[model samples]
Target chain A: MPDEQARRIVLASRPHGEPTAENFRLETVPVPQPGAGQLLLRTRYLSLDPYMRGRMSAAKSYAKPVEVGDVMTGEVVAEVVASDRPDYKAGDLVTAPLGWQTHGLSDGKGLRRVDASSAPITTALGVLGMPGFTAYAGLREIGRPKEGETVVVAAASGPVGSMVGQLARKAGARAVGIAGGPEKCAFVRDELGFDAAVDHRAHDFAEQLGAACPKGIDVYFENVGGAVWQAVLPLLNDFARVPVCGLVSQYNLAGPPEGPDNLPTTMAAVLRKRLTLRGYIIFDFAGLFPDFLRDVTPAVRDGSIKYREDVVDGLENAPEAFMGMLKGRNFGKLLVKVAG
Target chain B: MPDEQARRIVLASRPHGEPTAENFRLETVPVPQPGAGQLLLRTRYLSLDPYMRGRMSAAKSYAKPVEVGDVMTGEVVAEVVASDRPDYKAGDLVTAPLGWQTHGLSDGKGLRRVDASSAPITTALGVLGMPGFTAYAGLREIGRPKEGETVVVAAASGPVGSMVGQLARKAGARAVGIAGGPEKCAFVRDELGFDAAVDHRAHDFAEQLGAACPKGIDVYFENVGGAVWQAVLPLLNDFARVPVCGLVSQYNLAGPPEGPDNLPTTMAAVLRKRLTLRGYIIFDFAGLFPDFLRDVTPAVRDGSIKYREDVVDGLENAPEAFMGMLKGRNFGKLLVKVAG
Candidate 1:
């Protein structure tokens, strides 16, 4: 029998700095039937990303802020349980921006059908998903690492960074990963096949990073942007490219950090080195989605590009998992298994 | 008979903050004779650009710092008085990196013959030369403003900024220039044909800039950084491109300005707006010089792209003129008339 009740996590209040459990409210509602041209989607896997932190704040960003009562924004791998649309049918897997909800009613728009035969349906939210595509697009368009060039990415064990390292290696560049702990660093170095992995939590991280990048860094995929950026700045070679995807390190800050005013130094380095720092969101490269899938799906399926997930069971635990992910507690592509 | 003695400005001492006459020593030396396969060149017009400030410091930059006792690095429009090479360049005008000297010796390797018949030889140092090429290449490669988009450039009356404003207009973008005072602002808006102009010296400079760029800035040709950048930051529209060629305002600064750590704010804006901030030197686009000449030379000849030069007579006055140019004392392209 189909479950009558659906659960969703909504923004209860805006975060001042770090988002807490109180900021997210879990509520239960009756699963509504799909009317004309609508599909009833049952969430299978919900993707939790660092960018969601931006949406939780009232401050202006690329995406709209989630209001007090609205569902927290996220992408989800789901099953179409019932469909009135011509393109979708019952039992078909698809990915959609259905928020942090177990069930959602979609009017058959912006829903991408996920092929369950080639890979695990959950991969639709991860390795062959938005995070993976982000690394690919940013690198191809901006980073453009040449052979023997050093390409560095933080959050190394996470989906985006993992993909970035692997892609850099494929381009014949030296891939360097920066992760929080020794375990994640080992995984990035061993499992992901990056040339080197440095633990950002290490006391002498900057020195260790310098040691790892003997030739200096040519491409730094900037996601963790505070001290990591400060460390990477001096090591960046002339004509280096920095494709800024996220600033996870600075995302939780309620205000600017204590100052020596690093902007002048940053600008000076940029001018002297002829560096290119371009910031872009995944949606900006939406047109390349088909190309990304064509290239990455095969790589993931053939075991050439590997991905790991840290799955937390139950929709109610999303806030905790998300908060943990922000602090680098979650080890890999963070996901919430909402339902079967 | 050719003069046996020539005067050259040498870097006597490095400037701690802003450069002064004491830092430059007037050295009278015998004119260098061209050896086998070399050419003896007499300086005509020496370009005094803001980039020279970087050379004055011992700090690591794209170009090697000019050592103390060495002739200060500069580009000059010169006359090839004698050539031993097959090219036969006697009395031919050429533009070369001949430093701050009245006469120089070149191997003809990097010498490009200047066409004196087409335009005034001084134009090769101003409108039709390196400064103009800096504007063209930076805009085409980085600050690509589309039709009706707002483009802002600081130091509007100067060589680089003037060309940037005119090029932006040619691309059908609304060019808004920021100069030091009312006279320069009036020149930028009325004489240079910019859509609007704002004086950076005004008390309400930021507000005035905001008012000038009604639709917000799409392309910001950043040559003058510091407070000007702070003002433009909030006004940059989504996907705005900032092609950073120089940071003249901060060039003389001994250390970082006191602040609330604007880097985080800047990074946040870059991420939210998906902005592109790229820094480049003119040599990076040297291959595009011919393309630049083809596009700009005709327009300059037709009076569509007007240029003004502030020529300071005699090589000895170069130090004073260069120091004054840094403080925005010069009304146009700052040049030192070395020989004639």
Candidate 2:
């Protein structure tokens, strides 16, 4: 086998508290060779998300952890360097599970070629990818926002949330976005065309959210669950639907929150309000993906749907970017540029 | 309007803790007149449910409360004395929203003429009426039990819980019943054909529940929702569905439950387990009512669905019957037999 260098980020150590640089390792390894229907690819961009925090900690989730000696798992945009199958050829740009590595060898499985002419190749990692699909299916299937109703989502500047707001607007519902900082909040309202934006870090977040949603929140796209959930619950209309897609706020917690539990109160509200709270993994509803891509792709092309990418240059800085993501430091879709 | 002697039970006062005889007042009044399309029903049976307790109180609910001067709201099986409508005549047995009274007038609007030839008129107040319809729709629509899966229901002695268990069995699932005392637990197992029955009042209730179902709970018909919910949550399997019909345990609470809140833990379970929790009023899904009656009516006539009615022979006995029903004092469906 011919030896070729591939830059990789391996999980060095599992996180004890908030993740640090010591938890990830940068190394140069031999580029893998394609066998059978496999393809040799060079990764252009690696997606960084808050869910990776769970993968880092060895906790049980929908997906398994990135083990100590394995490359950190992620979705990537890659250019085919070589191919052994008739479906693909060298120079074809594709979406693959390349992780945080410069070179990836796929056995011709779970690889889909992306059309860079219609949209940026990087978008296949953001608005046209998993995050985008998450927003599309969650809103259409679970949230089921009707015209003139209000749909509130946290992490508004992130890819999933940005698409959630745009798609909600396309469906004729008023979109209310919530973000951490003033800049992101402004971008959510002015740049993203959200009807209203609330800064969660602000002291009057609950009040602001209430004011922004005059008719009460008919649908709450749950991503950041904690105080955001607490503030949102009271404002939810009767028969409101909560599509709990993510809970990034509590991901880093090693144990249950401090005492004075309000579970009974939450339960009572659920009964009294006749609410529907559903949690789902994306693949559980794979039958809806084709319809989702068909619905969201056109909106992206016409600029009716907008997305932002927070690209951090280099695989070595992934740890810092990930840590920043957890703390709401990264703006829009946090991605690491693994190779040119 | 001709006056005819009739005995009635009125809400004398609202209770602070649990309801008592003093909260209700017995009185003699003139029989209500039957106008056009109306029937005068002699109350043979009046259902005493936990929901009636909510109506007796001044608290907010999906339905309005019974004012201090008004008669309590309830369903009653009656022998018609006179009717202004062409379809009814004297001695024709019917059912309607006939409060705790010896005789009352009902417009033909919501009244369904109970065919004594099909089944006894009293069945309309038990397994063939509101409680029975509730179990059918909730089980069929929300529970949607698959073959061999386990469905758990508490308050197994009551009409609603009893129907839930029987229907679950009919749907080809194992039904696990939970009741307060040993007698009701035995009844659930011996009479209802439950796979196993656990005494919720037992010190080892959780352990007993765990032992009852080897495969774990798939669908939980939520009726009693305080300590029982706490115990059942840990036993819920992945992708389990909970149909929130009623929170009987927390209905009487004047305010939020006392400290040591566990909301975060419950939400965490929802995320990790991918659980779906939905709250619904049976009538809100009134679309299922006709279908409910069509399916369960035959089951009732053929004795496939057996129900025990605890007849409290007088309007004055309603408050006591209602209180006892809440505390699991009634062996079967609690009812008030207002008149001969």
Candidate 3:
């Protein structure tokens, strides 16, 4: 009675620099049936993040790269259609790593149940999800900003940066956000309640950043890493802590950046200032997830922690949305509404 | 009467690159008098270290630069010649920041009493002083190498590096030492008891480092930067800790290093490997000095912890000794014997 074909996107080729639509290919395949002890899932929404750019390249990173012709890996909110396992049943919602596909089969491992009545189900892929947890764990572990200290983050309107600013403000620290344009900057300052927002695209971005934080930055939640990092480096105070979560701007780089080499200067500053720079992924702090949900969910429900989503309709638009998101074209948490 | 025309080295000029003899001027001035609450100290041994190179430059660092025509700043093992302070009297030995002068007046501030019978008084300058404390605090607070983990340090035969390796070994970690030549390398491996010693002068230095660190480096006590860092960067394991105490190699660097800019690569690795890099100076952990003395004094007295000194005679030879130390020509702790 229902259509047997299911749609999916696969990695067609690796890009040399910025990724393009051609690097991904859409295909139709038979919707997989649930085997013994497995559950059938129909995708509701697929989340696109900067980390996906790393998976496309054939280079060694924290995680393995997505091979050519394999379905591009991603997190998705899905509805359980049928279940062979006793724990899950029909019409139940869950968040699973089912990737860029309309339907998939899950073995019940790594699937987190989503309670629809608590909040919007889409929030699972944004505010209460990996991005929020990344900000939380990184700040708690590395960037322990004291009250009145300044905390800075780029991509201020994006999920991780938005949460980072909110958390920093909650900790009684001054929060500064850096975004590309006026509208996002306005949202970061007015809507997100960051102490100040700087436009990175401005001619005097570094000077503006300096003006925003007169005390100098104490905690910098580093997501976007190219020019923003260059601006932030000199502004970092002695004993500053940098929780390096992602280098979204650098994910697409093909080779080393243009000179004058900044490594020596960066290392020298790290030494002279007694700064601490630590790299981390959300999974590294998975043990803290229960604590993360305990703290963040109530704030989300009470409207104290706000989140925004730029959701594109249909699975076919995922490639364009992802490419545009890489260029920071999306205003908030970028997601693809794969199905109703 | 003893010579009233006391001699000291003054900063004649700042060096653009490597410091030359012309940059220092030996001057004769009337011996300073100790007023009430002051102690006059006669210079016994003047410590020469790589940090002096930084003081010779106009560039801002952790400590203030020595201004032109001022006595060049250094620590000295001094004998209390005359005392107006109740706590100190004539012939009492003390460690003082009395610069390069033959005689200096102290207001009793920052003068730590040296128990002449406890250990060699010069140990107050090398093994039991700032250099020794640097290795202890850095390794304890930042490095924290676990049992069986590997620790790497450069300037292997120097005070800091030698102590770092021994401390790492004490902590049950494999200690790898990097030095310039065969003699220093031999001293590091055979005498200092580092698990492995790699010659930075070897044609295949990086390969040798890699071979020595079969499990990869877990903790790196960064005393020397530049090529050693380039070698250590890739070999760093996931969650590797880098305690940056000094950058001896780049102390005289005038400009950014030659490109293909290494910043992006370094930052990328930092994120992907989840590395932790922290910089610190000894004073930052001065509170741990008592604990350091408690742990180290016994080891030194028992001959379990050993040290070497490359002592040069005369205050006039300090300039040459200091210059040679910067170029790694000095085999051990570089000091000038100002008087018996």
Candidate 4:
């Protein structure tokens, strides 16, 4: 590796409300050499997820926040450019936590080999990876949607939400997908085969959601909170299970929003209706990853499970793409192409 | 049944905020004769619970609200007077939903024979009845407090909260009881054997509670939801289980409280800390009653579990006692001795 330079984005400062371009600083640096048992990885694709927003803030959360002047943390599909470890060789494709950098050095631990021949390498970052497993584990272990029961999910065109809808359908439950617009709603209904898809942007979004769930919601796979959560709360039936995986809608808010405080009301509903609201990160259910891949991979291969990617062309465009994804502007699984 | 008369209390009007004496009306009426397979019950004791407040209002809830001019609904320990059913005979002490009346004709379907010889018949109205079963099912099933985990319960002197604290101790978990005053707190600590007791009436109640649970709260048996809930919220550990049984504090509130709506903040905490907040009615777990009896009855008999009764002598004084209990004035399980 002859002194190759790597381009990366770092957290410049924490955002007050919505993150702006100034919050991120892009810089070029010489790629560091891999020591003993280390593999130098060249980033091919970086997965942009809702959880990345949480890592940008200095607030207390499930995981440690990325400090100012540190590479913005993310999962990446990368190629091994040089290897000091016997397990990996130059040109081998692997998936690792390579952050926002175009290159990374790994100690051969936590890096998993990916076969490009089996499926597109990008699928490892979306349908066959953390997001996919999150849907599987959260649905099976927490949501536990029964046949004929209604399962509602928001951000329905995103990686996790799309998988959640498809999986709910596979489990014989009625899948109601809530997306931001007509195109995404159509894709969610037509391509993803969700039982119904409602546009959250529509003036009658709550009404449409209510109409979609005729028997009331039994399992609500909560990904995007805020208005979607408010709409879903009243519809939750007795013993309704809510697996809260993310709150992408409120991730950028600096503090609590204006209210006729609904917390007490929510708690009241929880008691009267016997609702179960549980929050979880995917790592808590990491044991289910192998099972997830086994179940989801076959469905994807047979075209029973469909996925779409909204790939931004360059690493420099990640901040805008990420911000756009937060606002429901991205069409599908948001990814950044870090290498040409 | 030769023109036998019965004294009863009926709903005069729905309360707007706090129920006044005008909301209740005492009246006299002829007792109806028992039909085939039915028994005429003479009310001996009536259970006054927080849930009755919900029943007084026309608001939507788990159970239907009591209509105007109807007998105020309640669970009662009654004496079987005239039995047309083979299973029930005259002089049998049984527990049933006889409402707030001196005499009631039951089909003998839902009546359970009370073993007064084993434990006081009034115990059926409390520690061995609905409240006991609620604490059992919620703790064992939802709360699932592991050994050494700290379990916090509000309304510590009430029938439900008392059972919860004792049951948590039985499960090898540290029981932290929160009550209205220093007296109830002392009973919770000394008599109930709770590991720690905090007085909610104290100005530094939250601070005292924080000091009490050094390891943080793992399972919060939520019977009272207000300032106590607000205090407990921040102290809850990662993956904490909240078995929301009642919101006694908010039952009388005519509308949503003033806010900086903490709903979003609470939901964010649920997401970040991976907390499980579940609401439940005891009837939902009625199948566990026998198991509850087998587990708790012996504990009560062996003095491993202790219970206190705040027995109000007359049914006429019930309205005042019920209102007082709502304001945390009841020292123990609030029961009205409706008869001699």
Candidate 5:
């Protein structure tokens, strides 16, 4: 019963625009003892993603909005401290959707025991987890980057985009990455080995993207669908494929921007260029998860694929870190280290 | 030989706006004799398709712009008047890229010998040919209409739209058809088996379209993308697929339309609803031809597919008919009858 204390963050209210710390509250409750076929978890890390902002809004989305006062939904890398489940035992590290909790009890279903012997436990959340799978599935399944083709991904230093750019390059396609600032751009270019990295906040971002992509963008891994889409769309080649995985840019908007609306022009361009814009959730292609892990996990081990993690310590800092993430303050994949 | 005389229509001048008959010239010329391995073709039917207007203008397109003073290009059903090639004999009915001419000589290439037995040979230029292929491939490939889903096609009485509307119905979806006038709308509703047909020219066309489909449209087969698109965009369901095949309504404009530009609004909807908008030329999906023939030709045989032809007699009148067709003056597939 020493594993009875569960420290967790819960949604207090849906934020109208940018999330504030007041929207989330940290509390402690007695963690239930594992019953038959269950495992007791000591949460070590909570994977914070941009997509969490979507769950904090009342807007309809591919995933269900997190209910009020429930633990803020997320995947966690945890150590199994105790177990009534025969499948797992103490000292076994595993990945589970344990939300923002410091300790959790699992039914032993949907838990995958990680082999820390193969790689460090943190890699499970960064390169080998949801973020990595997102990049793999979106790039291969929707992006379908052809050899010698140019693939452009926004938020290049972020986990999904970092992998998307790298994986596209691995497939023999030229990868152009777009990040927020010069430093992140340099990191993506130098660290992740992206072919070109442009800063979206630069004075000549559109021109820089144009100059970098002389052959025109063949695949645009669209994670940010506001000005980035506006910039990337005109530069798209006649047969470009845009895999719409997330619209992180629009996650904070209360409503549509005021406009001399350009919807018709977008439709016109889509018609003329024969562009393919497809929206997808990661699990929509869950049938490919086995293939995703098999292909991406080893690429991480050999350093052929690289990743960066921006760890914001403690559950209380989740809200502020997420808010800063919206403003492009964090570099790389943003994660909250809840407990050890 | 009588085959020595050739009657043809050529582009006289590029139209600054809607093409007038003055932009075309009808003339008689010496028909060169068929050389070795060549056949003299006497055009029986010249297909007056909307795409010809794009060729006449200096506008950039997927295909090369037709040179001014060149013979207007089109698909024609022709009769072999003389042949030196063993594959084709005189008096044989065939489909050829014969331009807008009464006579042509082919070296037995790019010509498909039509049996004139399966369906009317004219159909080779209409429902069973390029326009039909445009509809089938667009609807099946991009539209991906599910059973019980609502599908919409504009210019619904035209060769392409009529086929799209009918095929959507055959796929077990509800088809909503939009046409310019009451007559065309009636034909689309009655003969084409659409669930509802709305007249685009109606004062309350958008309201009518909304009334027709209580559930929002799931797939919009975009052939005419002017005022109709304005109405269609608002009615699109979340995750709707818009296969933009043509912009017939905007073809005549010399420059982009002015005032109340709606591009931003469209992009916002695209992001908000996770909509997909793709443009494609028929040749992009030409690989589907054999399969298209297998599926659609059978529908034609059983009357599950129906087509209407607006046949204009005599090659000299082709220019006038074509001009009328652009104004939605001609109904269904516009064809010029050159010879019996």
Candidate 6:
């Protein structure tokens, strides 16, 4: 038991505006033994998502904020190190909400066994997991892009957006991707096979987007909801569907920006254009996981659906990686390698 | 030709903000004789709707704005005075999009014969017309309130909002109506049978709305977007459906309001609460007309659905009545009596 020490990061305090390293603290403690009907998990890979930024703030959101002095909550790919449960065996690869820790004890609830042979173990934390399902469900349920329609997605290099664009193309709709720089924009167009790619950070971003969307945007996958949303709003065609998954640009804002308020304008556009703007979390469509796997798994396996990963080694580095992801710094599905 | 004079109101100038009487010009012209395949229509009742305010401005909207010096466009109930078409005859009551003229010439393409014996001919302009169908379609198609859920509607004394509250009640849902004044609030509560009514003009309007909706708002029929929309936004429950039919309050704005903008807050709320905000024009759901007529016609016939008309006499008074309707001055369905 003395040798079974768990290294973990805990929330030191809630963030104001942008998160700093001072908000987190690293600690080591004796790993608790698995009780009856429980299993001991050793974290292999930790998912670092933009949503975790929301969990750091005390602000009201879909999920509760991670409390100060507690283990920062997250999903992790882990291996069963010890088991008192008959269903779980030692050395079994699995995925669970194990937080920012090297070792965790679970009562075997909400744990899904992962087949490492079918795909890499890290894919369980990225393309084959929550991020992937978010894109699948939001597109299928909300976006509903008909053939020959134009589907625009910002943060196009990220896991959710890449999936959305590819899925749109698969549905016979034109896919337009918006990214922060030339490299990511190229990746989104050349590698991901998007119909068009526009650099959001470019001086002529809005103009480029307008030119890209020749038929007007029919389905806009809204994740970055600031200037990108502003650019997409006017371009949206009548009866366009917007699947509002995230607002990464506004996550760090201390307060609403100055205006000439655009809320009325947005609502006016919504009314005049007959647009449908629907927001959703992946958990709401969890029942469609099997269908998502069925559709995406084949496309992914056949190389029609491409994925990229930006892995930052060590649980200690998760804070920096997550903060970077919020600012569009991470190139893809960001993950933290919790163990060697 | 001297006896066949037609008096009409035309758009003299586009209003920069709130419209004025100077923006309209009343003129009498010799009525153009009906050509082959056309019918001469003498307008009986003219509908003055909130949407007409949008038509008075040169701003881009779902429909083209009425050009300056053109007859201000609207729907009207009329009697066939002369027919060159085989289908229509003299004295037959019909509905057509005939603008603000006392006389009009139609090719009979969009005319629907109104059964004067079935219901009040005025009902064709109010409860049984575009306004009624708007409420029916928006509620049934977008709001989709389940039994026992809470449905909230603003401008609840108006044609559309009144119908929405009654329809929500018919569907076994709690209907909370928000109206401008005490009298209108009382009318919404007692006369219209809403579960609760909150006065938007009250100092403690938001607090009163919170008290009225103990379970939170599930469906908000958004026709009046401004302060009322601001108050209702925070009260919306997770997965609330907002069928945005109008924003009469913001229609008169020359430009966007000063802020602390709330657009990000709205988008964030949409994401956090998983809300669906859909905007629609009545014509978008025109296919549901027969269904609307079938469902609502009987309800009105049985006295289960009630209607009130704020009828202003004389076509010359249309500009004044329309201006009043925009300011929420009219008590119910505002209309102009064009003929004796």
Residues A221-293, candidate 6: write the lDDT tens digits: 9998999999999999999999999999999988888997989999999999999999999989989999988
Candidate 1 structure quality by residue, lDDT tens digits, A199-262: 9989999999999999999999999899999999999999999999999989999988777888
**Which pairs clash in model 6?**
none
Q: What is the DockQ of each candidate?
A: 0.78, 0.50, 0.85, 0.85, 0.38, 0.91
Looking at candidate 2, what is the lDDT of residue A282? 75
> Interface RMSD for each candidate model?
1.0, 2.0, 0.9, 1.0, 3.3, 0.7
C-alpha lDDT of all candidate models, in order: 0.93, 0.85, 0.93, 0.91, 0.86, 0.92
Give per-residue CA lDDT, model 3, range A170-204, as digits (tens).
Answer: 99999999998999999999999999999999999
Share of native C-alpha contacts between chains A and B (below 8 angstroms) recovered by candidate 6: 0.93
Hey, what RMSD does candidate 5 come out at?
A: 3.9
Each candidate's B-chain TM-score, in sequence, is 0.98, 0.94, 0.98, 0.98, 0.97, 0.99
- Give a tens-digit lDDT track for model 6, residues B112-224: 88998888999999999999999999999999999999999998998999999999999999999999888999999999999999999899999999999999999999998
Clashes of each: 0, 3, 0, 0, 11, 0
Return whichever of 1 and 3 wins on DockQ: 3
Q: Where does candidate 2 chain B have its weakest 10-residue lDDT segment? A: B256-265
lDDT at residue B25 of model 4 (Cα atoms): 94
Across B1-340, the per-residue lDDT of candidate 4 in tens digits comes to 5777788899999999999999999989898888888899999999999999999999888899999999999999999999988888999999999898889999976789899889988889889999888899999899998999999999888899999999898889999999878788999999999999999889999999999999999999988887888898889899999999999888888887877778878888898989999999988988899999998899889888899999998778888998998898888888999886
> What TM-score quantifies how close candidate 2 is to the native fold?
0.91
Question: How high is the lDDT of residue B308 in model 1?
Answer: 98
Q: Which parts of model 2 are misplaced by more than 4 Å? A: A1-7, A12-17, A20-22, A27-37, B1-7, B12-40, B56-59, B82-87, B103-105
- TM-scores, all models, native as reference: 0.97, 0.91, 0.99, 0.99, 0.86, 0.99
Q: Model 5, range B167-268, lDDT digits (tens) per residue? A: 888888999999888888889988888999999888998999999989999999988887888898788888899898988887787665665545544554
Model 5 DockQ (Cα-based): 0.38
User: Over 4 Å off in model 1, which ranges?
Assistant: A1-3, B1-3
